[model samples]
Each structure stands twice: as structure tokens, then as C-alpha cells.
Target: MQTDIEVYVLSCPTENIITWLEASFTLVKKSTSGPLCSKLTLLWQGNEVEVTILEQAAGKRFTSIWFDSDKTPWEDDITCAKQVFKALDCEVRCNFQGWEEEGNQDPDLWWRINHHGEGPFIWN
Candidate 1:
């Protein structure tokens, strides 16, 4: 079974995405030891969480994102993630299906953010 989680998928350039992520959490170490792309280890919930920055295909200019953290107070991470979206002025496709497994439908919904202005622009 998966832990109760919220995954935020974003589309943005490398530098801007890194900037937003750095602002959201304390940077523990940046590992250029990876072959594909540099990985970032960040501090969240008093623990280290890893995030991979993947470059999208040509003509797309979008980036893929992922993170790992403990269960307690995941909401704090959610709030921080949203702040990154807003800071980057980028759209986000988010799913909280883990909430569904726990019979908590509130976070199980899907939403999209379009940055026409300062907003999440989330819709069901």
C-alpha cells in the first residue's frame, strides 16, 4: 500500500524550477554524481527528501518532478508545493489518489493549475 500522498506534476524550465524548489525547502546537498541530470536532496519534516529534475522533450520545455517524505504532516509539504507552483508561475497537474485508498476523498481529487494570473485555477 502506498502512503497517503500528493504528487504535483509541473512544467517549467530547469533554472526556474530549481529556484522554486530551493525556495520551498532547505537544500542539503546537490549531487552531480548522477548520469542523467543533477539530483537535489532537500530537508523536509526534519528528514531528507530527494527530488529529481528531468528535462522534457524538445519543443515541450516542460519538466517532471517527484518527491519523497514521511507521512506525518504531509499537508505542510502540499502547501509548500503549491507555493512553488505559484512562485514559478507555472501550471500543475496534481493527484491525491492515496487519499482515496484511505477512504478520504477530500484529497483524492485531481486539479489543474493554469497560470493566466496569480492563481491555481484548479478545477474538478
Candidate 2:
């Protein structure tokens, strides 16, 4: 048995660190690979959150998406998925481990998967 949950993708991310990233990031955006700076993994409570830059600075507009943590709620007006990131008071490092593991497993087994990629959901 495995416990799976709804995955959410946040749009138009407005993190305060955007200014730093914009000023310091120098890598050119690639069509497929994109820039390394544009990718990141936001982990909280052992759950995986994929945050990727969807668009570049368009006249001061910076946009990104947060996937896998913004949709679900674990407490009264508090989301368990985002709690860890907030507590750390920092940015998360980008890693493909979580996405690779989930992709290896059946795409539908999402519910059985944990943020740590430890899951193989058993079906009835």
C-alpha cells in the first residue's frame, strides 16, 4: 500500500531572491536543457517540489512554476508541503533524483510516491 496525494504546480512565482538570480545568473538559456540556474527542487517534509523557470525577465516580469506542493493542505490554513522550505529560510538545490525515480515508476503511481521518491504503490 502506498499513500499518494494531489500534485500542484504554482505559476508566476514571486520569490524575493529573483533579483539575485537575475543579476548573478549568466548562463544562456538552451532550448532543451535550458540554463542550470533555471531549474530547482524545493523539498519539504520529504516531498518533492519542482520549481522551474518558465519565462525570462520580460521587462521586469519574472515567472516560474512550483509543482507538487502548492495544491494540497495538511493543516488548518497551512500546507505541509511548503512548510519545510519556509523553515529552512533558504533556497533548495536542483536535483533530478526525485523526477527520475518517479518517471521510472508507473506514471499513475504518483499517489504511492513520497517526496523522497520512496514508493511503489500497491494496488488493490
Candidate 3:
């Protein structure tokens, strides 16, 4: 299982993200450092998870949600993306496979989930 989770969604509002977080986890604290970024501290399964939401992350239409902690519910970014897509009812994206600093991974390959379905695509 992954120690952290990070995924991107298309055009999701910050308020909606907070609402989903509040409903899914025990929110400890929330702070908006700027208009485009927000940080959330949450507790899940007796673990502290730090989540960061960054707007306009990809081409001004996508937002990044990064869960920095061990013991996150999902095993990898793709799994996490699926959950986010379902909860937020928006398009979500993640690397096609687990990322490694020195691994020979194709950067353009990505897993995407949306209202239509979920699949792998060459993200450009």
C-alpha cells in the first residue's frame, strides 16, 4: 500500500473538496494560505493526514489534491483518483502506475476517471 496519495481533478471547486473531506474524514484543521491553495489536516484510522489542494495546477483547468501521510485508505494514486472522481463527480487523473524517482516510467501515460468511465490515456 502507498504511504501517501496524490491526484488531480478537473475544475472542482475548493468548497466542494472541503465538503468531501469533511464527510469522509475527521477534519482537524483547514487553512488557506492563498487564493489558489489550501491545506487541510485530517485524522483517519488514527492517523494524521495532511492534504493540500492547489488550483490551476494543470493548464488552468485542473486542481491537485495531495495527501501526505502514511496509512491512507487507497493503495496508490489511481485508486485514490477513482474515489475522488466518484465523490467530487468530476474528472480525475493520476499516473498510470506507481511512480519512482529512478524508474523508467512513461511520463505521458496517465489513468483518468470521469463521468464516462475510467481508463488509461496518453496525457499531453
- Top candidate by TM-score: 3
Ranking by lDDT: 3, 1, 2
lDDT of each: 0.56, 0.34, 0.91
Winner by lDDT between candidate 3 and candidate 1: 3
- Per residue, candidate 1 scores C-alpha lDDT tens digits across 39-119 of 788887687777776565222544556565543234643454466566776766555333443475554355455555333
- Candidate 3 C-alpha lDDT tens digits along 49-120: 999999998889999999998678898999889889889999999989777878899999999998788999
What is the clash tally of candidate 1?
0
Q: Alpha-carbon error at 118 in model 1, in Å?
A: 11
Q: Which residue pairs show collisions in model 3?
A: none
Clashes of each: 0, 2, 0
Model 3, TM vs. native: 0.95
User: Candidate 2: how many backbone clashes?
Assistant: 2
lDDT of 1 at 31: 70
The segments of candidate 3 whose C-alpha lies over 4 angstroms from its true place after superposition are none
Worst 10 residues of 3 by lDDT: 1-10
Residue 89 shift from truth in candidate 2, angstroms: 15
Q: Name the runs in model 1 displaced over 4 angstroms.
A: 1-11, 33-36, 57-59, 71-81, 96-110, 116-124
